[model samples]
Structure formats: C-alpha cells, structure tokens
Target: MALRVLLVHQSFPSQLIAVLEALERRDDVELAGIGMNPYARRGLRYRQYSPVPVAQTGDIVIDDLASKATLAAAAAAAARALSYDGFVPDVIVAHPGWGEALYLKDLFPRAKLVCYCEYYYLRSGGEVNFDPEFPPAPPEVLHRMRARNAITLASLEDADVCVAPTPWQKSTFPAMLHPKIEVFHEGVEVPPADNRATDRTASGGPSVSFVARHLEPHRGFHTFMRAVPRLLRADPSIQVSVIGSDRGGYGAPPSDGRTWKSVLLEELNGSIDETRVRFLGSVDRRRYLDALRHSDVHVYLTYPFVLSWSALETMGASKAMVVSDTAPVRDYFTDECAAVIDFFDSRALATRILSLLRNAKIRTSLGGHAREAFHDYELTRDHGRAAWERLVTSF
Candidate 1:
C-alpha cells in the first residue's frame, strides 16, 4: 500500500516546493496538500480553504491571537473535509508559524505530525532589541512577543517530530523543546563553477550588491546603504545594485512613516552616486542572478532570525560576499569562505567591501571557498531529497 502524506502551509509548496517535488517523484508514496490556495500539481491532490477573517480590536497581541485561532479553525475544516473524501493521511508535515498546525493533531490522532519549527520569537538573543537604533522593547512589547508563540508551543506539544533549519535557528526556541527538535535544512543544488553567472557588469565597471525580500534594517539595508557613499567616493567606476522591495519587514517600521530606502537615500542624497546605484525592486530569478553575477562583491546581512534562502543561493552561485557576523551566517560561512563584518558598523562594512573590491585574488578565493562550503553543508549532515524522504518515511 502507498504511504499517504499531507503537507500543509498557508501557501502549499511555498518553501515546501523541494519537498513536494521529491515526494511526488517517489513510486511508493502518495502525496496530497492542504493550503489556503494549493497548487494543482500533476499527481498531487490539493485541498484549498479560505482562511477565516479575523476582527481586530486595538490590542495587536490579542488581534494576532484571534487571527491564528481563526486560521487554525479554517485549516482544520479543510483537513476534515479531506477525510470526508476518504483521503486520510498517514502523516502530516506542517509549517506551524502562522497557526496552521494548532489543531492538526486532533484531526488525525493516528497520523504522525511533523512540525516545521521555523523560528520562535525572543525578546533577546534574537531579532528584538538587537538593533539599538530601533525603539526599546518595553514590557508590553516583550509580552506581546511571548504571546505570539501560543501556536508554536501548542503545535510542538503533540508533534511527532520537530524540525529546524539551522543550529542557530533551533537554539532560538525554548530550551525545553531543544531535546525534541531535529536540525535539518532544505538544501539547494550548487551549480557547477562553469555554469555560474559570468562577468556581465552592465556598465563594464566594478560593482557590488545587496539582496533581500525587503530593504529594511532587519536585513542590514540601512548599514549597507551607509557604506555606499564611502565606496563610491573611493572608486568612481563602481556601480551598486540593490534588490528587493522598498517595504519594511521582520522589524519595527521606520518612525518617520516612510520607506527605509527613501529615508536612507535621502540621507545619502548628495554624497552617493544616485545614477550608479540601481534599486531593482523585486526582480525575477534571471535578473537577480544577472545582478549577482555582474557584481564584484555581494553583501548579505540579517538579524539573528531566519536565514534567507538568498544567502544559500548566493553561495551556490559562488559570488564573493561580505556577510554579517551573526550565528546563522556563521553556520554556512567562515572567515575563509567570505568576509564577515560587524552588522552595526558601516565603517567596518565599507572597509571590508573596499578591501575585497581592491583585491581580485581574495574575492576569487572567497567565492571558491563559499562554493565548496555550499556543496558540503547540512544537506549532507542534515538534508536533501533523500533526507526529506528518510524523515517523512520514518513517520
């Protein structure tokens, strides 16, 4: 008999695309999905549900709790509907951050539950309070952060297995849950050296880049922008590309009620070369790679939060980079692999970028080491399609 599996997320196959493709290829495993809007794959069945609307009062923490509860209720209804169609799964793997996993165990008591524990909020040793420039975390703010973990804790309570992507990410959860969590990453394929993006600098001059889903303080966009003027002043021919939207994310919004990009750019108005800096807001994969390839160096910085897949992709492409010296980055890079700098100090960031830009040998060496490291990371000690299969089948 085929082993039945159900994968759950707000959007089916968002981060689970790799896992979905892997399972769908197996001859002995039956696959299905439950999502707010699940995609129609060739062999995989999907169930979609409209999430229940949540009403808001003035209290954000209370509103968030209500939102999670309603989403859980809506998701549970979809799962129950799946069973009504005679498709009970043997196991369920879910991303629990948004509260989809809250009531799943009750729906399928016999089925094993695997919770993708992405990250647990923390008042310290995490994103909050890390940036001193941001508003101080008062008692209410800390309380609100803790309240948001209601779903995360409940999901893990009955989970048959818990998975976190990296050691640093896993460490962010409460110590009590540490014993049950498995450290595994959904890995990326490293493209061969010859297939990497070649020198296609649009201006045919030296270039650098910074990428993220949003240009905000959380990803060190402000600091990267601060370093730009110094870099441009030092080299007239250097061009820079900034990727992602002008939106803020994962951190507090700028108090000035404006986009961080605009705020930072206005601050740097006369000092930096506006014409040389290209803010490619939200690009496709081809353009992203082109921007990356045309660069002399890439800069990726983030808070002590979830590591971006962009960082992994950058490594696979073998781009020379200056990275934030944070735990999540240390998990994938070293001094031998990429340039590490203090996330706060723009002066240090500028110096590192200038040093790498000036030295072709070191940039080449860093890119080479980064590629080697990318090929040998947790995907070996931790994951791959085979690893995902092994974990799924074990349940």
Candidate 2:
C-alpha cells in the first residue's frame, strides 16, 4: 500500500530538501507539501503537492495580545483551507515554530503529527544569541517571550513524534516530551574535495573565503574585517574573498550611509590595503563551490547557532573551519576534531586562523577529521531514508 505524507514548513526548500530527497528514494511513498512563499521569486513548486497559499502577515510580532491573536487566526484559516481541499494526509510532518501547527490537531484528527522541533527557550544566556549585540530584555519582556513560546509548546502536544537535529535542541524540551523526540540530522551528499592545486601567485595571493547570505552585524562580518588588518600585517600574502551581496542591492556602492559592510571597509581602510580584501558579490553555485574548493581556511563565527548548512557544506567539501564555540557546534564536534572558539573573542578567533594558515599538517588533519565527521553524522542518507520509511510504515 502507498503511504500518503504531507510536509508543512514556512521555509520549504531549506528544511524540507533532505526529507524530500529521502522520500524520493522510496517507490511506494507519496509525498506532498504546504509552504509559504517568503520570497517573491517563483520556480517549480513542490514535485507532487499543490502549493499552499499564505498571506504576508506578521507572525513574529513581539507584543502579547496582537501576537497570540494573529497566530491563532492564521492557524485557523490555514487549517480551514487545507481541510476544504480534502487533502487529508495519513502522516503529517511539520515545522511548528511559525505557529502553523496550532490547529493542525483539530484539522487532521486521524493523522499522526510529526514535528521538526528546532529550539526551545531556556533561562540561560544562549537564548538571546540571535540578537547578541543588544543587552538582555527586562524581566517582563522575557516573561512575554516565554508566554509566546507556550503556543509552540501547545502545538507539540498534537505531535506523535518530534524530530530534533541536535542533542542540545532535544534537551531544550521538557522531560515529559523527551520520549517522543528523535535525533535526526539533515544529511547531504558528500561531494569529493576538489584537490586541484592552484598557483598562489596567479590569483593575487593565497586566499581565504567567507560565503554566506550577507556580511551583516549579526554574522560577525565586521569582526572578520577587523581581524583582516592584523592578519595582513603579519602575512601580506594572505587575501580575503567575501562572496555575498548586501540585503537589497548588488555590487559595491559608493559611500553608502552606515551600512555594515561600509563601516567595516572604513575601519580597515588604512590598516589593511584595499587590494588585500575582495568583496565578490553573490555568485552561482558552481562558483561558490569552486571558492570553497580553493579556500585554505573557512571562518564561521556565529553567536549561538544551530548547525548552519554552509558550515556543514564546507566540512563536506573538506575545508578546515574555525567555528564559534556555541552549544549546537560543541554538541556535534569536539575541539580536537574541529577548531572552536569563543564567540566574542576576536583575538582568539584570529589566532586560530593564523595557526591553521601556518600549520599545513594541522589543517590537513582537521580537514580529514571534518570530512569523517561529516560522513558519520551528516552524509548518512540511509538513516534519513529509514526515518521516513518508519514514519510511512506507521501511517
């Protein structure tokens, strides 16, 4: 018998890509999806399912009264639309953080719900890592934030199973919910490393690359720019290639008023030569992978992040990384296996980079270990397939 499965998520391509790929391997499974079009760019919709329509509403509003009402109403409306279409999935897999799962239990009473639980807030300091630059909110504001998260918790009660990617994430939920949670890493294809040697003199000099969506304040881009001056001072042969564009614009603009990139450029103007830093705005996938292949070191600094796809990609490509010593990362790889550092300590980060650049043996060893770790934890396609198979079988 063919199993009918429906996956729901706001960010479809990102979280669902691995699961979709895994499901594709099965001959007897039917997979469909419902997701929001956050960006305006249109492409081929989900392979099997019709796309679910969504309004551009403020689902993340901080205010208590407005936030609760907005989420409740949206959930009710979404449930009604899906139910009216006569799309009753045997098994439903959803990412519940966006409040989409609020009324899912009521709508699909017979279906078993499986949730992708990303994070649960705790009283600890790491919860504020998303907005690290700002000081901690007042007690009342914190209470309100906790109250907001209650809706997320309520949604979980409807879930028959909950998938969490990291141990830290699994630990965040209450003890009662632990039995229902399963640790599942989103696996990716481990591409063979492009070991093709390049002439250092040809591309100006030995270059390191940072690839991400933007060089924003939150991503520690400015800190990296600051470290560039010191790094260049020590070794003039080293160059930095930043491969990404600003939020709303492409290419370099002349003296824009106080953008994060502009500020960094100004700060490092005199200390580091302009030629040493190259900001190649966003490039295609081939170019991005090529940059990773050619890079000597990849620096990934985040305040407190769950596993970043970019970081994992770099690891899969066998690039040595210097990542922040956050809970999510530490839960995955130890210091001996991968380079880890304090998030706020720029000096420590710079020192790690310098060490990796200087020691080829260390770099090679770390890269090898990173690749092994990736294969063990990240590239296990069969495991993901098995998880999906189990979900379908239960259905």
Candidate 3:
C-alpha cells in the first residue's frame, strides 16, 4: 500500500509545489492537501476551509487572536471531514505561519507533522524597524508582533521537524527551536530549454529588469524606482521593466493612503523617462520568464524578510543580478556571483546595473556563475526532492 501524505498551507503550496510535483511522480506515496482553495494543485485530493465569522467588537490583539483561532478551527474541522472519508495520512507537511497547522496534530495523531517555518517576527533587526524612512512600529505593535508568533511557536512545539527556507529565517526563531529546524531554499525551477540562446539583447539595448510578487516598500520598489531616473539618464537607450502588482505584501500599508508605487512616482515627479520605463504589472508566468530570459541585468531588492521567488527565477534564468545585500538574500548569492549592493544606495545600484549592461562578457560570466552556484549549492527541485523525501520518510 502507498504511504498517504497530507500537505497544508494557509494560502497554498507556495514553497512546497516543487516537493508536491516530485511526490506526484512517486508510486509509493499518495497525496492530499488542505488550503483556502481545493483547486491550487491539480490531481491531489484537497479539502477547502474558511474562517468562521466572528463578533466584531475587539482590540487588534483580540481580533488577531480570534481570526487565527477561527482558521485553526476550520482547518481542524476539514481534517476531521477528511478522516470521515477514511483518509488518514502517514505524514503531514504544512506551512504554519497562518495557524492552519495549529490543530492538524489533533486530527492525525499518528501522522508525522512537518511545519514550514517561513519567518519569525522580531522587534529589531527585522522588517519591523529595518526601514528608517517609515516610522518605527509602536510598543503595542511590537507586542502584537511577538504575540503573532504564538501559532508558529505552537506549531514548532508540535512538529516532528521544522523546515525553514533560509538560514536567516531560521535564525529568527527562538534558540530552543534551532536544533529542530533545518535550512532549505524551496528550490528554483530551471526549465530544460533554459539556455543563454534565449537572450533577447541581440535586438535591444540592455533590457533592465525588476520583478516581485508586489510593488511595495518592503520588497524595495521605492528604492529601485529611485535608481531608475539616474539609470535612464545614464543610458537613454536602455529600457526598464518593473513587474508585479501595486499592493502591499508585508508590514502596514502606506499611512498616506497612497501605495508605495504612487509615493515613489510622486517623489520622482517628471524626472523619470516614462516612455523608456515600462510597468508591466503582474504578467503570466510565461511572460515573466520571457522578460527574465531577455533581461541583460536583473535588479532585486528587499528589506530583511522572506526572499522573493522572483530573485531565484532571475538567477535560474542566468541573468546577471544586482541584488540587495539583505540578511535573507545573503544565503543564496554573494559578491562573487551577483553584484550585491546596499538596498538604500540608489546611485550604487544604478552604477552597478549600468556597468553590467555595458559589459556583455562580464554579464555572461556573472550570470553563468550565479546559475552554476544555484545548481551546485542545492537550490533546485532535484535537491529539494531528496531532502523532502528524507524528512518525510524519517518518521
């Protein structure tokens, strides 16, 4: 009989998709999942759950606690419904950031629980106070941040193994949990046809590229935008493409009621050459890859937080990258492999990108080295699959 497996994530398999794909090819394992939607992954059996309605009157702390409690309850109920169908997993893997995994252990006591620890909230040396431009989060907000870690802590205490996607992310957890947590990159997808022949710079003058899930301050959209005017002024022929949705992903939304994109545009005023700069907002995967494949140089910046999938995608596509020297990013790339720069220094960013664009030989060498490093250092699906199988089968 095949081993039954259950995967859970509040949103979906953002980090586990590669592992799920690998599992799909296996004849010895059966897969199922519980998420906000059942349609996230095809073929796998899935259960959908939604937060139960709650009474409105409460403080931020109370409301936050209630919301998470509701999600945990819903997930637990879904697992029970799955159990009613006589489906009991041998192993359970979940990303516990959103409290979805808090109650899974209760539903499947015999199943080995593995929790994906994406991030741990910190009052200092983290995203909360990393940017001086934004007002420091208040004491109450900081307290709430600590309180928010309750679900993660609970999950860690319950898990058979804790997997963190990066070393820096793992470091954020309490020292007691370090022994239980291990580092993983969630792996990058390198398609079979991924080759330098796809470079479109043949017809265009250095297509400078930037990509992220959303265009927000946390991911350094403002910083990248600030550098664009100088970059455009330095090389009028180069065209820049900024990809992703104009929305906030982390921290609080802009207090001024304007998005980070609007704020940066207002700061740039008429300085940016609009015709040369393109905001290709949230294109499909194929289009995004085409943009990266054609990119002469890719720029990625972020505060001290979770690494963006876009960064890995760019590196996998073998594009010369000018990345921010943030804590999370340091684990994947170094100065030798990528043009690592301080996130705040727009001038340095512009200069580095300009140099990369002008020197094709250097671009090819840097990009080649970066791609090789990713493959050699266990950042692909092959390595991820091996590590995941080891952990899943250990119990």
lDDT of the candidates, in the order given: 0.84, 0.68, 0.83
lDDT computed for candidate 2: 0.68
What's the TM-score of every candidate structure? 0.95, 0.82, 0.95
lDDT per residue (tens digit) for residues 1-395 in model 3 = 88888888877777888668778778888898888865655568888988889986557767777888898899888888888987799999998887888988887888888989889998777899899888888877877777689877998899988898878999999999999998876687774334453355544566888898889888888889999998888876788888988876776767877777888888899887777788889899888887787777889999999888778767776778899999989988998779999999988999999888878777877888888888877888777887887778667
Find the candidate with the highest lDDT and give its number.
1
Task: Please rank every candidate by lDDT, starting with the best.
Answer: 1, 3, 2
The CA-based lDDT of model 3 is what? 0.83
Candidate 2, residues 164-265, lDDT tens digits: the string is 877778887788999999887766555567433331424556667777676764456766777777778778788877877666332122245556777666
Task: Count steric clashes of candidate 3.
Answer: 0
Query: Candidate 1 vs candidate 3: which has greater lDDT?
Result: 1
Candidate 2 — number of clashing residue pairs? 0
Please rank every candidate by TM-score, starting with the best: 1, 3, 2
| TM-score computed on alpha carbons, candidate 2 | 0.82
